[model samples]
Target: MTDLSLYIHIPFCQRKCPYCDFNTYAGCEADYSRFIRALNQDILYEGHTRHHPRVPTLFLGGGTPTILKREQLDIIFEAVDHGFALLPHAEISSEANPGAVDQSRFETLRRLGVNRLSMGVQSFDEDELQFLGRIHSTGDAIRAMTLARKVGFENINLDLMFGMPQQTPAIFQHTLLRAIDLAPEHLSLYNLVVESGTPLATWVAKGQVSEPDPDLAADLYELACELLQQAGYHHYEISNWARGPLQYDGLPHYACHHNLVYWRNQSYLGLGPGAHSSVEPHRWSAVRPVGAYIKSVEEGVSARGYEERISKELAMAETMMLGLRLVEVGVDRQMFQKRFGLDAVDAYADELSSLQDRELVSIDAKRLRLTPRAKLLGNEVFAAFLPE
Candidate 1:
């Protein structure tokens, strides 16, 4: 009867973006049938071992889950349905690339019990989209959103990024306004991080591109917080905002439930290549290589290539770090005491006091949260919570 959240990674994409370093492959989608089989095996193994039959939330994320044909997508869902029983009101969501979206395809996904669609519409500006090396144009993204709405999709999320090379604050604000006009239920406003080993990193290294200014990015983030809140959206997490007053457990919860499982340090299972999973002290990630993951799962070997047992102190630190990301809820004092047998305020009194002195953290009898000024300096505050 454990309330488990399930995640399935679809590692196939039409092409990789210049900035992306996620474990996804381009031009290898022809082998999707084999990949689906491997994924099912991984799910079956997890279902059997965990003995948790009911799943409350399921998220299909990745390279472009919608890239698979309707029938191909069905095969994966069938395996999941057989392996684990979904709760009656489970939140079933799938991430899609705007370029690959189709009306019929979206309709089929809705028919197959997908309640949410998170579209990767990085930018609605042609220049920005091209700069990001995205295949879809602004027209394509608009058309995709229109089609999704027409096909009975009520709960939708748009994934966007800011702080790109040559992007001015004006242009970023324009993109945000355009996205708001479309009126998705959720918005993920992320700052572009230049990951090492990506094509964009090479561009920066070779002087072909200028990196985004951290100070400018901080200003853009603050602008987003201001604009989104004014538009009646709740800034629930650092990068996530949702339309106001969505009821969950009698609370005004507007955040993504699947991600909440991670931020709240709850247990969840991840299936497919490069997916990470955790159940209390034990955490594991699947083999990074698709071929290797398939081979191992097909051969009845565990897909996990790495595993770790988190220490109690580390877990407490992690909980504090993550829970504080929820700007509204923060870390509840009583919950921390119950879980760790110590007052969070007392355990990290020194760190909290230091941050508070700098006006970066605030604490009351009930919760510990970051101050508005500290939101941009979250990384600095989070680093202080790391186990020493």
Candidate 2:
């Protein structure tokens, strides 16, 4: 049976951060309840498929899943358990903002079978937090970490950001040091990208703010890689690091498993407004508007905005691009040949040789993988997979 992953989106937040463009509504409690009901229906509808087995990972992501009340979560969990088979040791993770957390809430989540927590602690500096328009203070982040530990959460991942407006190397180093002091089991160090429609982008366009220089951002990322490595964290993926064998022991093993499914070209069922899913040739996304999604579900209608069946060639190219993200899951020559009936090494000989000559890639007898330096320019490498 093919393993499946589940992604549940919660689109309610107390406030939307300026840098965020996720499908989220600020202070929409009534809409949240309706959305959860709709989500339950969608899950049941998808469960009729026999091709996919019980999901190994269930990810609750959103504006802030922590914003939901325990009672609301209980209803959603019960509905999901009824609609889909969950493995006994399935990894269940929820994304939470520091300001939305509390001891009681954390304990409640633990009892409800959430095995992992991914906290958004973008920065540990108060000034930087404000600059990013985050709702939490630096102290709030610390307290949230403490509460997670006290509430018996053994697997915790901290999401951090670097290269913000007015951010210097010294400031980023301080933030990194603070995060290290917290000693999270996993860390995701992401560079800030100002999306075109976000407030930060407008600020830059208006000359009110200046983004960190690209060269400086790269330097900071390299520094973080070195620092985290020295602290005994393995740079497994470009932006992900973990500590020792403890890394894959439990929930961390399933950390963002939904995303892993995408990387591995596995199938998934996504529910809730603006959620997306893929199953073999077909890909679909729900309507982004919360009201429309809920109304369609209530009327027993599909909420999909668009659906398309991908071609075999498209799927192969996608698999190559996504699988290359993992340091261990290098491109296997035999697997590629079996999948496409073509020898990858020979088909892309020129590009492969050129990249190898540039010190961006390395090839063993059966596999090809990006070198450490190549990870910094991953987009450029991935672009080679795209057709001209």
Candidate 3:
């Protein structure tokens, strides 16, 4: 049986952040129970059709998965358990808002087989939190982290962002220092991108908010790289740093397994509205509207509304692009050859030569990786991989 990762989306949030454009709804009147039932039906149908029962990792991601009541979460877990043979030691992770989780909730999730908790604590500064329109205060974030530790969650990851309006190097450093003091198992440090359709975009366009300075963001990122490494965290992926060895697999470092599935270009199934799934060259996305997705599943239709089979050449280009995101591993030459039946170097010789000329990429016998300078300008190197 093929081992696959599972991504389950929860599209409900207590309040939507203006910077977020994910398919999420924020309101108290939505029928969560009915949605949960639809999710179960979708899972059951996929389980029967796919016939692959081995799941290495399961991630529940969303606007705020912890916003759902304990009972609703329970139903979803039941569905997962019934539909798939969850590995005994699979990394089951859930993304939670700092304001939405508590000691009891953490305890409940632990009992329900959630071994990893990723808290969306964008910043530890009160003013920054407010500026970002985050619902949780700095105090709330601290309290949530404390409760997660006290309730026996050792594998904790914090999601943080930089490059916000009014953000400076000093301010960002302060936030980084505070986060380091908390000492979570993993950290996802991301630069804030003002998505086109989000409210932040309107604010920027209207001159109500200033766009983040790219040069300053790069400086802050370099600072983070220096500090995190000094703090004994391994820079495993482009934006991820992991500290001690994880419980599962006893590896010397920890990384988000579910996301690694994407970076490694492996097969995975995504369930729930607006979720995207890629099984090799084939990719598909579910209907974005919650109501439409639920209705489709209930009427015995596939939730997927869009599908495409990626050409072999496109897949090879994608493999090079995604695999290079791993800071340490880079692209495994032998593995690439096994998958595509061609030498990566020969296939993209011209692009690689240009990139190497620019000091953007370094290719050794075993793998190809981004240089320190390339890490700052990753998009330029990745664009070179695209078919001209």
Candidate 4:
């Protein structure tokens, strides 16, 4: 069986970002103690039920993982340690906020064996940060990075966003340059997306802000590709870049192994409100409301709001779509055949031929991969593989 990865969601934030529609709440500190207890029970229940699967990668994501107090975080991790038999060299990672992390918080994280720290420093420009409703200023972001390094965090990832309203090429370049100067082990370049019902989306609808321009976003993405590549960072995925010593199978040493589990369409168990899990025969998503989720888990009833047995056809199609997201480690032909009892070549020959003709994909003896041009037109290419 493929090694199982784990995802733990933190559903609290200091202030919500306008563009974010994730299941996170602000001013819910009163529920912190109760939430942690429920989360612990959720993790323990799943761990025992799943037979203590060996976890290689664990991620703490959400509204703001750093919003929790040190004792709360310690309790959560203690539950995890007791429930799951983490591998000797697990990639323990957490997403942190710049304004939320202090010396004490940083030390607590390091002491808990959180080897990888991903800071959500969306921009290094104060004006851009304010426009995006980020609570952290440029100075705060810098101090956070410095403190993280001083606390002995060698592996760090910085997230940068571009292509917002009134954002010119120069403005983006300035932020990108500062990020490159800080030199985190990994970087994720994201374009501003206006998801429906988000504050940004509402602003765009009301003409308070303009929607992001695809053409401008494309230009910025290309610019990032040029600059990051020049700085010796490998564009491992469509939006992610990393630089370090070589890792197994030619991956960058700092590549996000936990996310790679999702990219590879492997099994993972998520524990938290609104978390999702994909195991061998089924895929399910837990209830989104924190109160309801806690009640369900505490009562020893199912917390899952939606569940479906995964069909072989759906799995194969998802394998092709998700595997193609890895720029370098595309769908392996041998592994596909071994898992599904049929070669991907034989299964998707028609779709592959069409994609190759359009110059969107390439199929070699070992793997089927998306071409460089397919990065921009990825949705269209991936859609071709879906059963009609």
TM-score of each: 0.97, 0.94, 0.97, 0.98
In model 3, what lDDT does residue 271 have? 95
Task: Report the lDDT tens digits of candidate 1 across residue range 1-388.
Answer: 6678999999989989999999999999668999987887777777777674789899999888999988888888888887888999889999989899888899889989998999999887899999899989989889999999899988889999999878888988888999999998899987899999999999999999998898888888888888888888888788999885857422235468888888888889888899998878889999989999999988987778899999999899999999889877789889899989999989998999999999988999988998988788888999999987
Looking at model 3, residue 81 earns an lDDT score of 83
Top lDDT prediction, candidate number: 4
Which is the winner by TM-score between candidate 2 and candidate 4?
4
Model 4 deviation from the true structure expressed as Cα RMSD, one decimal place? 1.1
Return the TM-score for candidate 3, rounded to 2 decimals. Answer: 0.97
> Would you list the clashing residue pairs of candidate 3?
none
Full candidate order by lDDT, most accurate first = 4, 3, 1, 2
Candidate 2, superposed: residue stretches over 4 Å from native: 49-52, 246-256, 334-343
Model number with the top TM-score? 4
CA RMSD per model (angstroms): 1.4, 2.4, 1.8, 1.1
- Give the alpha carbon lDDT tens digit for every residue of 299-371 in model 4: 9899999999988999999999998988877899999999999999999989999999999999899999889
> Which residues of candidate 1, in runs, are more than 4 Å off?
246-253
Report the lDDT tens digits of candidate 3 across residue range 1-388: 7887899999999888999999999994466888999998898778777784889999999978998888888888888887887999999999999988888788889989999999999898788898788999989999999998998888999999998878888888888888999999899998999999999999999999998889888988999999998988888788998987544432225688888889888899999999999987699999999999999999987788899999998899999999888877778888899999988999999999999999988999988999987888888888999876
**Model 4: worst 10 consecutive residues (lDDT sum):** 244-253
- Residue 306, candidate 3: alpha-carbon lDDT: 98
lDDT scores of the candidates, listed in order: 0.88, 0.82, 0.88, 0.91
